[model samples]
Target: MSPDADPRSAPTSPRPSGLWRTVAEIERHVATDGWGAPLRLFALVRTADALDRDPGLARRLPPNVLDEARADPDHLTSVEQEGVPAVADLDELLGQLAWPDGVDGAALVVERILVPPDAETEVRAVTAGDDEAGRARALAAHPLAEDVRIAVGVLRDGRHECAVRSRSKDSDGEVATGADLVPGLVGALAATLQD
Candidate 1:
């Protein structure tokens, strides 16, 4: 899911209760900053259950994510107690997932990008390139990325142009509590928008 996404309320998943539990855990951690050891233990178990449903989607919770979750037990007490620390530490980890290159920029290489700022910018359409067309389609779909077209050869050496339309704008937890929230947010938003 893109970083700026705001997930609508999830009304349709098998784990509505689990979602509430996760969200409660998040709120507890966010509010008290002291999610308690019980919260941590519960989170681990719930996360395990959530992961069991879809073993394929690990980007939201890479193998090392728990390590981030493990960093601050004291902060796990509650949102006000652990909220700042959990929010800070977890966001530190989530931000890494959001901005893998340490926030400077991402290794962007597009075969076709519909330039955002100006539609008249040079563009190209190449079938030989690998990621260009797909990336172009994605960029074209975003509301922030409009008025751009792919020219045949406008961007051979060019990468991303650092615009308002980026994939990981908010560092996940910067908005929500966990990067794990991304998939849910994506699903919820897709359903809402589709409806």
Candidate 2:
């Protein structure tokens, strides 16, 4: 893909069935677009319906937590606030999880990121030679981000899909693409299931 090209605009096959497919797509986008930014992730957990049915389990959980779990047995969601620490954390994070009362299967959603310009600063640095540092500093002064949404969801059933959509931060133009920004992050997310 050209540096100016948007990966999201490229053709995508029908959504794949397993987390590994999501992992592969993330790798492909990164190879084509170059990695950009840190990724934000979310974890979705489905609490057990047995919480409501099992009086003993109900007693162990806080009333509110139990009530919420009961009210939405199939939709318990939790987010990991810290940015992905490492790819290994993907599996580790999931393994470390201890759901309240009745949580069961889990899924992951990785937020999208902006695709940065190719060598915007590096080119300037090379041209400036002895003053390379100064040139790089100038380029960093004004930063622009192309608002894009390329979120990937990996379900407990191993079903996954990457959704791409875009707009400027100011909401000016509309175009779709951004997965190029955080491929490794998405890979880590997918690894949770793959591992």
lDDT of each: 0.29, 0.46
Per-candidate TM-score against the hidden true structure: 0.17, 0.35
Q: After superposition, which runs of candidate 2 have C-alpha atoms over 4 Å from their true positions? A: 1-40, 47-113, 116-145, 164-185
Please give, for residues 59-136, the per-residue lDDT of candidate 2 as tens digits: 676676666566554434334446546552445665554434333323343333343565455446456567755754
For residue 34, model 2's alpha carbon misses the true position, in angstroms, by 25
Across 1-195, the per-residue lDDT of candidate 1 in tens digits comes to 456665664355553232333333443333333212221211112234344455654466655654533442211111111232233232243233231111121111111223454432323332235666555565566555533111010011121111111233322233222223234222322222121
Q: Please state every model's RMSD to the true fold in angstroms.
A: 19.5, 13.1
Per-residue error for 80 in candidate 1, Å, reads 15
